[model samples]
Target: MSSQAAEVTEVLVVGAGQAGIAMSEHLTARGIPHIVLERHKIAERWRNERWDSLVANGPAWHDRFPSLEFADVEPDAFATKDQVVEYFEQYAQLIGAPVREGVEVTSVRKRDGGAGYIAETSAGTIEARYVVAATGAFQLPAIPPIVPADAGLFQLHSSAYKNPDQLPQGGVLVVGAGSSGVQIAAELRKAGREVFLAVGPHDRPPQRYRGRSFVWWLGVLGMWEASAPPQGAEHVTIAVSGADGGHTVDFRDLAASGIRLVGRASGYADGKLTFDGDLADNIRLGDENYLSMLDAADEFIERNGLDLPEEPEARDLGPLPADALEPIREVDLAASGITSIVWATGFRSDYGWLQVDAFDELGRPKQQRGVSVEPGVYFLGLPWQSRRGSTFIWGIWHDAKFLADQIGIQRGYLEYDGNGAPSNFVPRERPAVAAS
Candidate 1:
């Protein structure tokens, strides 16, 4: 290769979110020569887009980066979005990972050599031996098409929502029963707003079990050990399948939490909204199923003579009021005085920028562990990329180690120079940053 050709990095990480940051930590630790390309600034989306009341759904213990742990000064529960950003900032400084912010990647194409790629960005072009797409699923927000037109209601996706204070001083209608929707609805209600949550089926497990955080119990039960079985192994199963398909927040608990529960966001017609008739029944059955599973788990723990803590008897959180259902059928846009609607439906992973044939029938990039269908291309931060919890914060470490090992093994197979850099990449001052 000619020296006039663009400077090549060993690895180019795209999207500087949690996963990107985590990968950077590993790369810096191994003295890998890499650059992280961020479309916006570090932790930009988390800092700018998320709602003010938003805290991580996962507990604080499980949310830190791979090589770092949250200090005891913070609560064990959940960190607010602001705190999360602060942690990532410190992590960036700690690793001295070279991150070029505001450099949007326009295209990623296979280079002629078949062992590298050329990433065209807004700032410039980067030639690298490997590309890691750490852009998470949350980037694409899903919004329904049936939203009432001419209803004069302010609708905002959860990504754009900051707080309820931005909404008009009236009854608020929150759409979706996902974690964000339920939590935001609860926050609004706690603030004395007449808040109604459009309920759908959600998987709700107890945040704490046996008087300890659920994650701690996971560690106690060998759930974190490599020898531990798959998510099917009782304790890890629920957390594993919860996000992709099986996860749901308890609507009965939502009702008990003082948030009004309504049917699914159906359609707006004749100045009123219609909903799925089975929504109420769905919430009831979902909660029953979750609670029953918890009870079954407890029975299994006792039968196996596992060292388990005493569990509180579970109880049913009764259904929503029959009268609340009537008003929700068609909330008067002006009379009900609800100002904002937050769509927390879900996300879509669009890798349209990567012009490559690595995708499967489902359009997801095909890879064995983190290695791609195309050579020299690697992936990280995918849900269940290796195991059930592969994409979660705590689960990312295993994938990182696996990817690092794969890179090392492939380097050995090709006889590439593997031993090259100083042990440390930590910076002595604030890391260089740019805002998108």
Candidate 2:
């Protein structure tokens, strides 16, 4: 090993995505000396990983973090992937966030003698008083293990999908009927390719009800503030789309549009894809969840005495024509002329670089509201990190700010009053350092 000396800093933040930038903003505001180390360029995922026509699932208004709002874009409009990337880039510049791009962190471990943490990165070594893992929750794309390596089909995960033209001219099988799956299927169909979608349990909220957008209703109904996982309930996956004016996609609509709605792909058998026959049950479950959300919205409006118009009785769901609800159990890949498969299965967190015992039995970090049990360690941009919206762009600001204060307090730069409020804050006088 080279005898190079390790660089030192007060705080070191990994990943310069929205969460990292937000944390940098708070740290900067409080005069904390920190450097954000990003493995790629700022907003690299939105820039490279996402499809060309992808848009934010939430409206532009709700996508803003603290002290930064989408001024030029329409509030109700969904931001395209490019726009979202530009927004983050501009936000980083606006706040003058000290971000070092293309610095890949290899490992993070506690320093000897309880001094601090040492991070081994592509650049060199870095020792910091505190380390914040702001890599976000969607680190690794999770394709099902059942997908055979030698399936011989051109396969792409949703993160790698750009457009339909990239695939060979043949039928495409899109797995996982979440937001990514439905939207990608629509794009493939629009490109004049035959599409087959694997249906699963998901929520199908309409784009709008009455005169307001569904997101507006959710905001007004306090849905964003609800505690996530709901006190022992597993995290729910809602599959509403942001494309085509935020229309909801379901098996019925997809089937009506001439896209085959198959059951969840179970495995490969004898050159054929096996699937469970649960299309109808999945659709029924989705409808139940949709209706429950509507009821909750109605109750919120009634309880708060809001003068909103009644939901229109003629609300259209664009369901399938009576003949389109057939259950499909299997598909012969070769026989059906299928050439490409897109896995829209969700992502999982990969904290293999972390050398701390901060994870739970489920391999998730055991933290209370983003603060780790290990002092001076923290996490940001995790789903349900603190509340229902913790993972969303609109929610990370709160967690970032809170973690900044915690770091400040630990460094003796800030103190909490008896009422549990931060007071008498003072930033350190040392010159702030930024990684080159």
How do the residues 125-244 of candidate 2 rate in per-residue lDDT, one tens digit apiece?
A: 999999999998899998888758787899989999999999998999999888899999989998999988887767677667656677777787777787666553354467877887
Error of 1 at 169 (Å): 3.0
Q: Which residue pairs clash within candidate 2?
A: none
lDDT of each: 0.68, 0.83
Mark the regions of model 1 whose C-alpha exceeds 4 Å error after superposition: 1-5, 148-150, 217-250, 256-258, 300-309, 316-335, 416-436
All-Cα superposition RMSD per candidate: 9.0, 6.6
TM-score for all predictions?
Answer: 0.81, 0.90
The per-residue C-alpha lDDT of model 1 at residue 357 equals 83
lDDT of 1 by residue, 266-371 (tens): 8876556666665666565556656765675676678779786765655545545563444356565566666667776766677888888888877788987778
lDDT of 2 at 139: 92
TM-score attained by model 1: 0.81
